[model samples]
Target: MKAIILFGHGARDARWREPFDRLAELWRAQHADVPVELAFLEMMQPSLEEAVATLGAKGAKDITVVPVFFGQGGHLRNDFPVLLDACREKFSQITLSTTPAVGENVAVLQAIIDFGASAL
Candidate 1:
């Protein structure tokens, strides 16, 4: 089976995870066939490894991680590779891959711009 991990940069406030939770809910609702999990780089319940484990338990052999960040900052560019490498080492049976940060997509940026325009 295939699974997805919505990866985010965790914030200090617990409430900061609300959006991630909503994203997971949305994914589950829309894509019931594929399993989804939320993972944070810090200050959260399940780290990347834990998320991978959860999917592995569900019998997921191919896992794709989507970085739900606004840009390819240091966290994505520097820290993420190390975390992914660790997960690979820990879960050698699973095929783990990652997508570019959501912010890198032009459509996503356009949507943000459209939202800002609507607010103005």
Candidate 2:
């Protein structure tokens, strides 16, 4: 089976996990057959390493890591690759693919426009 691991920038605020977890659930609901897991860069329950290991343990040979960040900042350019490298070493048999950051899409631009229109 393949697993989708949604990676997010962790926040110190306890409430931050709520929305991230909710989004993970929504994604999982859309793809009921595949396992979906949430991991944080910091200040969270499941770090990326832990999440990937859990998925590997569950027999996920192909894992896709999706960055739920706003842009190609430090986390995307640096931290994520480091985590993926660690995951690679830990789960030697699994093939991993890291998807682009969500903010790079046109839909995100449209959402920003919609928000601006509503605010005005």
Task: Score each candidate by Cα lDDT.
Answer: 0.96, 0.89
Query: Which pairs, if any, clash in model 1?
Result: none
TM-score, candidate number 2: 0.92
lDDT (C-alpha) at residue 57 in model 1 = 98
- How would you encode candidate 1's per-residue C-alpha lDDT over 1-120 as one tens digit per residue? 999999999999999999999999999999999999999999887999999999999999999999999988899989999999999999999999999999899999999999999999
What are the per-model numbers of colliding residue pairs? Answer: 0, 0
Expressed as tens digits, the lDDT of each residue in 1-120 for candidate 2 is 888998999999989889888988898889988898999999887998889889988999999998998889888898889888988988889999988898888898899899999998
Instruction: Work out candidate 1's RMSD over C-alphas.
Output: 0.8
